[model samples]
Target: MKKAVLILSIICMIFIFVQSWFLSLGGSYFDFATMFQGGIVGKILALLFIAGGIAIMFKPQVAMVVYFLGGAAGVLASMFIEYQDLFLWGIVALVLGLMSYLFNREEKEGKPGSNL
Candidate 1:
């Protein structure tokens, strides 16, 4: 179950990058005002949430907080962005990160002489 969430979270991140890449290419670098004027905002928010999901690999406990905050931010961002998928992806990351954290805690508790 944890692995499933982790994989899904990765896919979300990949999709976000792909979408953002294409959106970014549509504009010129010289058009500074338009760089972050639209969909890019949601992409940035999604990236932050994905980053939190990745953190679960190194620090499950810390990632818990990040995921919570990221999820909230994504929900807030969804209010004004056309890419509502950001909210979906953020919720996914939050669930996955929490699942990973719980799994890690269970594993540690099940082990002998372990301190979590």
Candidate 2:
């Protein structure tokens, strides 16, 4: 489960980065500018997500906060922007974020009897 979340995070981050870059280059392949409210903000969000992905790979506990916030922000942003596609991705991110948080919590608490 942890592996799956990690993979999903990485994939999502890559997609965000590429999409942002495309927007930066004046490419409207995904209409992210309209979805994000502007090209600059979209690029910034992508950069932040890239950072969040790196944090998830290294410090997952800390990254959990980022994931939750990002997920919520993505959902809200999508809705307000009226972008159905982003809303779906937002849902995906939210689920992956929750899974990652749960996996990290389990790791921290450890399995029963493991101390023995």
Candidate 3:
């Protein structure tokens, strides 16, 4: 579980960072146009998800909430964009959520006052 969580989290972070690079590269051949069409607010939200991914690497607790929100936002945003593999985004989100849940579950199990 830990290995899965680590690998997925790293991928999310890498994706986020790569997005910023894509932004600098004029976003040709990439699906940046649709996201930009979402306006400044949407861009900001997307950036938040990227930031959240980075934070997750350092702070799993906060990352869990961020991941949940990011996933929800992605699902909603997908309705407006024409991405090729949007379903994969949802699956990634599901994987992240499950990983975080499993990791937390084990942590709680070892603590005296845990709710698990």
State the lDDT at 107 in candidate 3: 69
Per-residue lDDT of 1-116 in model 3, one digit per residue for the tens?
A: 54556666567655644553454344444547764443332344445555555655566666567667666766676677644233345456656765676677676688997763
User: Model 2: which residue pairs collide?
Assistant: none
Q: Tell me the whole-model lDDT of each prediction, alpha carbons only.
A: 0.65, 0.62, 0.56
Q: Write the per-residue lDDT of candidate 1 for residues 1-116, one digit (tens) a residue.
A: 44565566667778877766655555436454343343576567557656666766677676677667767766676676555666776676567667767867886898998963
Per-residue alpha-carbon lDDT of model 2 for 1-116, expressed as tens digits? Answer: 65566667778767766665555565365545564453444444455555556677677776677667666767777666534445555676667667768777777678787556
Q: CA shift at 31, candidate 3, in angstroms?
A: 12
Whole-model lDDT, model 3: 0.56
Question: Which segments of model 1 are wrong by more than 4 Å?
Answer: 1-3, 23-38, 113-116
What stretches of model 3 exceed 4 Å from their correct place? 1-4, 16-35, 38-59, 113-116
TM-score of every candidate? 0.66, 0.66, 0.59
Model 3: worst 10 consecutive residues (lDDT sum): 36-45
Q: Please state the error at residue 69 of candidate 1 in Å.
A: 2.3
Query: Largest lDDT belongs to which candidate?
Result: 1
